[model samples]
Target: MLILAALLASAAPVPVASHERLSVIANGEKVGSVDAVRDHDHVAIHYDVKNNGRGPTMDETIELGADGLPQRWTLDGKATFGGDVHERLVRDGGTARWTDAMGARTAPARGTALYIGQSASPWALGLYARALLKAPGATLPALPGGRLRLDPLGPATIGGVDYRAFAISGIDLSPDLILLDKDDALFAVLDTGGATVREGHEGEVPALAALATRLTAQRYAALQQRFAHRIDAPVRIRNVRVFDPVTGTRGDPVSVVFADGRITGIQPPDAVASPGEASIDGAGGTLMPGLHDMHAHVSLESALLYLAAGVTSVRDMGNDNAFLPDLVRRIAAGEVAGPRITANGFLEGRSPYSARLGIVADSEAAALDAVRWYAARGYGQVKIYNSMNPAWVPAITREAHRLGMTVTGHIPAFTNADAMIAAGYDEVTHVNQLMLGWVLDPKEDTRTPLRLTAMKRTATLDLATPRVQRTIDRMAAAHIAHDPTAVTLELLMGGRDGAANPAVADYIGHLPIGLQRRRRQAIAPIAGPADAAAYDGAMAKVKQVLKLLHDRGIRLLPGTDDQTGLSVHRELQIYAEAGIPVPEVLRLATLAPEQYMGHDQQLGSIARGKLADFILLPGDPTRDLRELHRIAMVVKDGTLYFPSDIYPAFGVTPFAAAPKLTLPKAMPKAAGAGPAHDAMDEF
Candidate 1:
């Protein structure tokens, strides 16, 4: 029996011999070959795989072994296989097992297995197959066996791990996945695909790759230097119109002194203090602590725009890439000027698209890993997105709080805002989340169980309703902050009609050409009969939800979910249109966000010891709120930037003369019997 078993195992497979050349064929088609080479303990079969066939070869697998040992194997097209290959293997090993259907086993000197697959997307499959043929065993999840030759691209820190980046051509990988073992073997690859691969190259792959490597390395080094610096510098601003956002009062012109980046004094106009100190004349313009756009995209350009718009601070609710620490460093060191930015690097979920930008945690273990990942990277909070399983929320929140990181995000599809808060969500976005909790039926897609029950009980919730007030009271008691992003909601609701509001029209000229073109194209499809009614109704619902949240006294912070730089100002205007008092609306943009971000003492007001981040407008914005559009100058951390300089950064040509402002005309009276239409009368 033992001899027969041995024969069966031996006949089962044979390892390739040293110096032996072998060809690999699947169904009579030549696919790859191996070049044999010998080392001390083992013989290495270096293989070359190629795919020249018109269609993607299917039901193919490579069986590998050494000497008489049966080595389990896998075939990966791109080094980073998409989908849940690992999980699939764990769940059902037989699904990926290699087997021959026909006959009794006959061992050959080398073994082979059939890979079963049908191309889903032909072009993508062809590319993947071609890559695999070019680099057989290259897709093997193991370290490279030789010293890697990398063109130094730059320095970068990914997921808090610092690395000197080197550009490697002909491979798609993220810098974070590149790894080198101690044996001088390249163990992993970083694929930067899509437009990002060609960002700096002017369309040349090699040149772009080299530039990417160098830029990444430089960025890493700069970040390290920035992190090393302790922020203890004293700052001062003089001759500014100080606005007390909390009190809705404009204080007398003053000179504010700051030490160690904290407000030290707020004095009358003529206070004389230290010599050789930085002083901003404020150009006789309004000065307040930097404005905060609570919801923003923290790109370098966006950061600059935020500053240009007099936004000294921002809270990035979501972002991809594990580069938050570096972004924070750049902003802090003034290396790349912008706001005092706080970021939630990514949300956690279980979808493919979500995995790319969020932490993919299908289990409690994975969820815990995600929390630690953000905490170690210096993220102040975690923003959860849709599709997250409610079961994971409590564990995620517990782990995050243990690490001192707050949790916030959209209430998941099946969960209501109340459940999310009870699960330890520090803040809720979008008033729609709350409204859905009250009126939606559980059986409908929009209804959550919490909402259905509340509605069945005839629960009336407004800023003052007991249920709504209780929720707010609990949040306040817990020191949890809210970011309503009322302006974004308004735009989504009111601006969907064919007619553009004044605020929207003003922004149209300022938008980047590319974005504007895209928007124009996008609107065309929605404007047609088939989609118009649905779009209009959806927008009206959004507005109704916002009014409900406001009537309930829920704390509202100004946030523009659009481009972070210019949209924030537009958001404030939208808030005014939503019936928020102009002064209160301005406060939401200025002091409110600062308080939510826990930087009230150092930001959100123009006082001694506060960071000098403010904008100068031609008129008082609190009076008309529209005055915000008249941006004369922007001061960020004591640095003055003129409108001319800021507009160019936005890819807009600053008009030598501001465009004539004319309100949209109402539909003409029937037969023109009434007074002649006045376009300027709308505002």
Candidate 2:
């Protein structure tokens, strides 16, 4: 997530003599700009970015103390999805106070107690790093919560200009990698898929982004080495009940055996263990097919989180074309830990609001070319974005369908879901995209955050209305599916400034402090009690629509556009809360998605002939959907992973303990014999 910079501009601006300009690049495209002005102890930063039709726009002002850390800071602006932002931090004497999404809080400051602003500009990272350099051990107690540590990544040369690189950890699951100039001022912030760099040095962003990704990959690779158990011998999980998706029931205790990445057999719990085999005591738990996130944007961190949440398969709705293919390769080559990905080609029409993920076409012919490009690259589907030309959908869908690729996406600007379905779209991407037609005027653009903000109008909507039923009827008649992303709606519209978000409340405490604070904040602007009630009513309406769709036999996909992996579980929870049976909800999360993507043969269930892709849970999920959260172990392609061993690396408290693993007795070696090709030796 990009930093949500400052809010409103200062009423009385201070003149500055020095200025630095930075460019915000996403997927190799320029999406935004940042201007920093310095005048003595005061620094003003104006940040604005517009990509995928929406980004944060804010102004930040900081008054530095003698130690070069902020003494007074103010930020006000709009968040990425149109949430209101007005954050402030003030340090006076030995006391520090600030107000953010978590409301106001006061903490005693003692000898450089650093304050990490919730909506600070990227420049704040450089400021924090500079101060931490002076702190003992390059670490300091941070405000709100947690500790900040600065680790040098050594030097980098971009465009023949030398700079020092550092990683600031503790605020998030992954550290923030930053490049600082010789003066210790901000120069660039590098990320896996995007970057913010000096204006003239934008040409080096791709290289810098790649380097950031490599650095992060190295860390995850080390984790994979320590946590991924890829043994060479048969592995048996004993005393576990297998959940049958088709039957919607858990069978009697059994011992499941797998070796060399395939399931070899399923036997009784009392079956005798063979030589050269490893055994795991499942402790009478349930062994079910690993869950699937129907909608996702995969990254290395999210990939690991998916496994921790017991999600083995994900259908990536959109991602960086170059980055995604490489990630897939590394995952397959065993360089990192991740879920099986089903990539969808991102197709957008070139406009000011175009999402810079994949092919951006300006003409109908170019759109068709984009489809062929995705087909050649083996993308399973084409995800049309908001800025695409409505007129081009028919041809794009036709081309994608001809290539045996599914067509799914948002309703393009100025068009409704009815039109896209008529144009041969196989599925609609977001629930708002489908429902906005019933509430918005023809001229109101769904290309912007209005797609989310407009849901407030749903409070007054009548599902029985002719226009609403017409769209639902057409989708049923056309056999078109809908990915409601209901959890996203709940997160956007239902969050209050200081209250815990219902979508993620169950496990929010297990996350880092920074993430916990963020989850409690409202994403959609709720001005007053009336507006809050409207949003609440709107969320209720969203659930009602989900129930209607399910009752009408319209295939509903459980997807969270948010890619934390945990959200996918919340997505299924919302489905269950919408009156869908718990068993059916589990089916939607596992078998239905696999069947939708034609991946069921190998991935959707736990069977003797299927790939060894399942998760071990301490409880029966059929009895309670919440049991899905406590994942003891995950076997992906026969490689074992225990969540309890890997979650600490990301600052997450483990939810379940690892099951006991018993290895076969090692054969005594001959006095002069060479090493044997045995399972223990392989490990």
Candidate 3:
């Protein structure tokens, strides 16, 4: 989440004779802009994007050091979720010093070491590209840690202009693909569904976004060919104990046989192996069904990540209508490695604060039309977002139900969970969306950051109050489900500047430096000791609500609205911490979501004739949820994937060794083949 701040002042003029400007488009809508003024080696920038009622507002000043690297850089702004941002970086003589939410540090300026801003403008990518071209080997040692590399791609012609392209990596999990003019100035930053382009070239967004998608898809396809193992013969996972979701216990050691994308047999460990059957010695590890992330926003990177984390299936909460279905088709056809996806149609009311991810409708007929569009495309549900008119929900829900689609989303602005449940929602998307109703006055708009900052009020909320219980009772009465995404709230309310978030502290050291810093920074600003304590208490209150929901028979869906892969592990762990039994927590992450999504018949359990979607772990997750972090192998649709083989692609260290796989006598070769560790350089 790079915090590109969007000022709330008058709109900046489009590119003119005096200054250069770029338009920030999301889902075909121009929601923000970046304006920059340059003079010699000095540049002043004002970057702002207001989408979803909250985006950063930042002013930046930079002085270049002749090498295209910044000699001094300063940024002052409010972050996306309202955290304060006052970051500074300077290179003086032989020393480089910088300060951010993570505090200040000094390191010797050696070679072409570049200081990556924690809250820099998107233009920084262009600067980096220009500088890397001058560095030895087209690479430079980064300031905090690791090294950044630039890979020049072939020139592309967009809107009748030839532009150079490059992919830069070493900051985040995925490389940043950008386009530059002939002069090596950044012309545009392309993404899967949106893009930021020079003011006069707004019409090229669709083409560039498509190019971004194609490039990303090609990369993942190559990875699939390299790492995904599809044996010609059936695979028998021998000497593995199955964790039976129905019985909530580990079963006797068994041999699980699968081929042609279905589980064919579960037999005694000594069962005779067929002539063409492959074998993997699970060494008495626990085999459980692959996990499910009920709330997700999928991309090529996140898709591969989900598979590595043993999440074999996901329900995309919302995404670009054009991009998601095509990605799903590619994954299903085995051209890309990803979890099975069930996409949800997103519907939002047109407003200044509307989220720019999905279809925006301004009237009842338009909202109904959106529902029909999703249903026609086989979308499983429709997610209503903030800025949606409450008056439109009942009609929208009715149409969705008439089309055999489910409804799940935020309690729209100016409304509450009680209203949505009464109107009709199969499930509520986030716990904060529900809890806010109890603490907020009807006049206070939730579309703004107030929805999150007001969590402080939850510290004093009494769950026993009738107003709170009434909403719970209605949900229970209506059989409404909840995707607490408590892990998301934990990150929002409990994060502390300069300390790793407790939600990700266990594995922060294993991630790349950029992500490590991201997880350590706060999302919501805390003004004082009282504010911090209130936020902490708000998190505790969230867990209490989770306990109440579970005890009251309100179904809880394990979902992480935050990270794509690793965060779901923490979601289940949080459930256990919230007093849900470990066995039940495991069920919530596995079987419960499947049953709720109507996928239980073919995907949820380790039964004969079911799809072969499961994982092998050295320890039983039924005993300690942390064992999930050590998954050795994941079997999805009969394809074998070793996490140890894929982790390095994202600059992550392997948590467990891959199991030894033995092919049949005639084949006489190892079945699992993975990319070499050096393959990480390509990312």
Best model number under TM-score? 3
RMSD of 3: 5.8
Q: What TM-score would you give candidate 2 relative to the actual structure?
A: 0.94
Cα lDDT, all candidates? 0.49, 0.85, 0.86
Using lDDT, give the best candidate's number: 3
Residue-wise lDDT of candidate 1 within 343-460, one digit each (tens)?
A: 8846656543232344656777887888898898788899887657777899889989999998887767666777888899987775555555555544444312231112222223
Best-to-worst order by lDDT is: 3, 2, 1
lDDT of 3 by residue, 1-683 (tens): 00110110112122222356888998888878889888767789999988888888899999876555688999999888878899999998668899988899999874367888888878888878877776657787788888889998778899989998889999898889999998777899989888999998889999999889988888899889877987767899999999878778899999999998899999999999987777898899999999999889999999988989999998889999888889989998989999999888999998888898879998989999999999998887899999899999999999999999989999998989999998889999899999999988888899999989999999989999999999999989889999988888888887899999988888888898888887888889888899999999998899999999999999998888854598899999988888999988888888888898888999878999999999999988998998999999999999988899888888887789998787665453333344432211111
List where candidate 2 sits over 4 angstroms from the true fold: 1-17, 667-683
Model 2, residue 452: C-alpha shift (Å): 0.6
Position 256, candidate 2: lDDT: 97
Between candidates 2 and 3, the TM-score winner: 3
Off by over 4 Å in 3: 1-19, 668-683
- Model 3 gets an lDDT of 0.86
Model 1 score (lDDT): 0.49
